[model samples]
Target chain A: MEFRGGWDRCCGEARSCRMLNLGHGGVRRLSTVDFPQTTEDLSLLYKYFAANQAALTRNMKKNKQLLEEIHVDLDIQEHLKMQEGARRFQQVGLFCILLFVGSAAFGLYGNGVVSKKHLTKDEINIHFERFFRFQAKMGLQIQATNDRDISISFPIQYLNHFEISSIVPEPTETRVEGSQVKYAFKGRDELTATFYLVPQQIGQIKGSVNVNENTFSISHFIFP
Target chain B: MNPVLRGIAVYLFVYVIFRILGKRSLAEITTFDFVLLLIISETTTNALVGEDFSLTVCFIMVCTLVGVDYIFSVLKTKSIWFQVASEGAPLVLVDDGKPLLKRMQQSKVDEEDVMEAARLTQGLRHMTEIKYAVLERDGSISIIPKEKK
Candidate 1:
């Protein structure tokens, strides 16, 4: 019988409530002894059923074990295989949910996939949310090496993709040099400048922090 | 949060959840099933809309939802395995007026449930009145009445 589930209705027209399945392959024949309903026969039926219970249970168990053998379950090897498949698919779906939540849940990962790198030259320890969602506020920390004047220039790509929401310890001078936005901090020792950045666009955004001659390139993916 | 992605996510998540819940869940066998469905719909609506109330977001959400559904339909047609995996096959619950107790138990169905369906579908008042009862993939019991004398 060509039985259609709720989902199967989508691909084709609605089926009429008539079954025309003749000699369906999944059918299994069973033979059972019928008992009479007379009071004396009923008492005898009870005794007979009690005696047959163990054999009945054994037959059912054997059928279950045979179905569990996988390859031997015949064409329609019982619905157990299908249930197993559905369970496996559910596990996969759950895994996807776990990954999605793990990578993007707000504050769950504490600023989201933080990347801390200590530059050898400028001693600029850049700690930032390397992975974040679109429009989500991400923290970017940059520390200067020793007590010296430093100018951090954000590349054009960064300016285009991310909007600088706020800056800590105001830069002495901020200027737009061509495509890059430059923030200059003069006469500062042991300075850690934090940039509160919000991604304006989604997907992987390539950017660079130019500290004098040293350029620290950063790539972050913003989920939509 | 983009409503388009959120819409798609909500749709797929609900679909998978419903699949895992099994076809019987769709029957909403009890009054409380409706309350559970309402709660789920409420959460999904919030997730799909978020803080965005713009018409553009609404349009994107609708399009994404419809598009994903279309894609799934196409996949189902293209792949038989996808069809079977998603919808499952029908199971025989009763043969020749005798209840297949093992199959019925595995499917979470009882003789009362099958007889209820039989009465509704074929006016079959007893197990002997039914020739065959199959638990269709959609979770509905289809009963075939025995040949009239």
Candidate 2:
């Protein structure tokens, strides 16, 4: 007999082929049908299959427990992977924050926010510098050790724009050399010379006095 | 300007900006968020230092900032009002498998976030399986699954 039209053709001459061709959906339909089968039919089918009801139930329970165990294990592994990723991210974030804070602190320190230079009196005396705005009186103290009168020359390189007609404590001799005034004076022993400067422009004044090849320079600023 | 005063002003200004932007602004980090954070820091650095370049000033500023932060933390711990003002209270977004739509909308938390939490914690596949969802103060969603029948 040819078994072809679903369950109606089962148990026919083609029963074995039909059973093999019945896929998962067909098997599920077959189970639903068997659920309402008569007791005699169930017993006959169980006998034909040669399986005890107790053994089938035990095997089914065992498979279900195994599946649940696998699911739980997979879930735990996934959770652990997520936690590991999160922990790595946290570590990287913490490292970045620390690096940023360190960079900021270093930047502040490098900008001179914490330390400053403290110069000594000798250094300042050697430099002999003063800053002034507009006109101001400036004095240069020169100490002479020998009794011989020493001639000194001060190069007025920064007072070109100033009114030289109003200079105080006039120099003994003033000579012009390439837009610069060379003020000469004679000093014996200790001497202090005072000069008055009136600025007519907005800029800086950097002048120097040459005494026997030793140069003493002074810097001043004129504000607008 | 004094370093301590400048530091305090900058700290307060940044604090106010973050507070106005709300807590969710920092809950998740995107590329844009990272760039924005860098820009904010660069601007703050310029404002804090101006033209001054002294190591002592920087040290004083850092000290003042730490002191202010410590004082705020102490105050927050001592006073409930300060705590509430600084850190918001936890909000309930779901109760007994029903979504509190208004609360969810206000908190910017949608149903998907709650469902994701349920799935992560309880292997749940549907929103109906969750009994409660709370938006905690730390910006995380806490889920409670419905009892199994």
Candidate 3:
């Protein structure tokens, strides 16, 4: 006789009967509890899971592609903005460089020469004493050297307070050799004097002079 | 004997002691941790700078402490039970938007403190907006928002 039951009741009855008839040899023939049956059920479940996994993977791949596209779009937008910023910076940089160069050149030419009268030896000496005393109070030592041919008296001051040391009249001079006076004072001491001077219609003077060698050169001549 | 080596040894020893104290020690950081740190620093400083101190002893102590720390870190990571025991479980201070006054008192947390934490983290102006407020293992408050849908 065949028995009919609802799916839940049938499943429940099957579980109970399998448990009760566990040791009986006839149970194997009546029941679907063998390894093969279990394997088959598992295979079907595996297939279902595999298919679900495949679908999930495909969805994930699509999502990743979408995200990558979005990232690329953002990167391109950022790149374009950066390029615009760089262009503006370049324009500004060019303007600054041009302005700097032009002003520098004008300053070089403006103060290039000094046509003023040369200060006499006595007058220079007096000025030197006053300058030396002032500088000595500020912790500096001055040494003077006189060269008659050039009418130049170079007073080398040891500016212990700063970095550079030379016997040059800086920023102002009567004789304009590229915005500087060529002056040197030499005495019994082998201490060489250097000259630095700036000419009034000429640019500033910035160069070293060798008093012993009577040699002078212009480093920078800014024309105003 | 070198000042540098001594300093390093002291630093290592201190690091190990602190590590052994665990994360909860840092989270709570009571007057105890501060005092411990101060005493440890004071004791170790003389040894670190003194010529009489042995570098070998210092390094050995440091290595031993560091080993202990490593073991604890490994155990905490591998065993969930150990992690829970070391860190402690979260205390529920609020359930269903209602404040659990007993739990708050037990946890040593006041209503004002909870409110401030909620406001700072979630902009929760009213207690009614909170679904659940859990005091986490780290002594920080975790809030769960009510399900809207």
Q: Assess every candidate by TM-score.
A: 0.55, 0.39, 0.30
Give the docking tier of candidate 1: incorrect
Residue-by-residue lDDT tens digits, candidate 3, B1-149: 34444455556555544333432345555788789778867877556544345777567556655666677689989986665554445556665455766456545677887787788888888876766677776668777755565
Best by DockQ: 1
lDDT of 2: 0.53
Which model scores highest in TM-score? 1
lDDT of 2 by residue, B56-143 (tens): 7788878998999999899989985565455555555665555756457655678988888788877888876766676665667778
Misplaced by over 4 Å in model 1 are A1-84, A94-121, A145-149, A186-189, B1-10, B24-52, B63-149
Please tell me which model should have the higher TM-score, number 2 or number 3: 2
Q: Over the stretch A1-224, how does candidate 1's per-residue lDDT look in tens digits?
A: 11223322110111110121212212221112231335564455344444555555687486643222112222343456666566566678668777767655543333632433334454667776656767767778887764667888997767788778899988999999998889988746677888988888877788788876678887777766
CA lDDT, every prediction? Answer: 0.67, 0.53, 0.43
What clash pairs does model 1 have? none
Provide a comma-separated list of chain B TM-scores, one per candidate: 0.91, 0.87, 0.63
Residue-level lDDT of model 2, residues A1-224, one tens digit each, is 12122432122132332444432111211222233235565455434333433454477476532111111101112122222233344456557667856754543222222212122232122222243333333333443333444334555556664544343345577777665456655544543344545555556667765543455665555543
Interface Cα RMSD for candidate 3? 28.1
In the order shown, the candidates' Cα RMSDs to the true structure are 11.5, 21.7, 26.0
